[model samples]
Target: MFRDEGYDNDTLEDEEEAIMSSAIPSKVDPLDFVYTNIPDTTHILKLDANCKHCKAKKIVSETDGFCCRNGQIELKQPEPIPELMRLWSSMDADSRHFRENIRFFNG
Candidate 1:
């Protein structure tokens, strides 16, 4: 059992490493390479409010989701509507009800 668990752990770690490596470009200076190869464009280190991805600019939120420079697709987070509905259904009437239901509230 212990040996089997160790083997499974090793497999998981290997898979994680493979995924992470694939996510990032293999170049020593990925940014430098991009700047040299690709056309002049804005450089973003992280996706935040100012970032186009977070602001849902350039790409439609309901459609394209996020944009990537190298044509690499950005995966969308799972929609919360269904999960919220499930939670609402499971909850009692009092617990589910909200006093002040604020809609379209953005930080």
Candidate 2:
């Protein structure tokens, strides 16, 4: 038989307080240390021509292309893997490090 052990509201509140305290730092503005313009750094995509598969607009770069309507179509450049690997290998150590450490943040 299950016996009712009375629910402890005080204990529940204490646990919640403890969790909240640990979740946030009591420090100065954390936002001040972050680079605000980091999100604005982007690659400009050049539109190429109409898509061959769907006859929609084909926006492209040296590596790949995307169609306006045939977005699901894989438009990877011929021998993409080898080309990408070659590009990766050609980059300097610092450049490679920077690319590897790229992160996206949302507020």
- Report clashes for each candidate as comma-separated counts: 0, 0
Off by over 4 Å in 1: 1-7, 28-107
- Global Cα lDDT for candidate 1: 0.54
Question: What is the C-alpha lDDT profile of model 1 across 1-107, one tens digit per residue?
Answer: 24564478778789889999999977677477557766567865543343344444452233343345424556679777874666446656543553123242221
Which residue pairs of candidate 1 clash?
A: none
- What TM-score would candidate 1 get against the native? 0.23
> TM-score for each prediction?
0.23, 0.25
Give lDDT tens digits, candidate 2, residues 2-106.
334774777777878899999998785778668655775677778776665656654565223344334566545576576456545668775576457645211
Global local distance difference test of model 2: 0.61
Candidate 1, run of 10 with poorest lDDT: 98-107
**Candidate 2 lDDT score at position 96:** 76
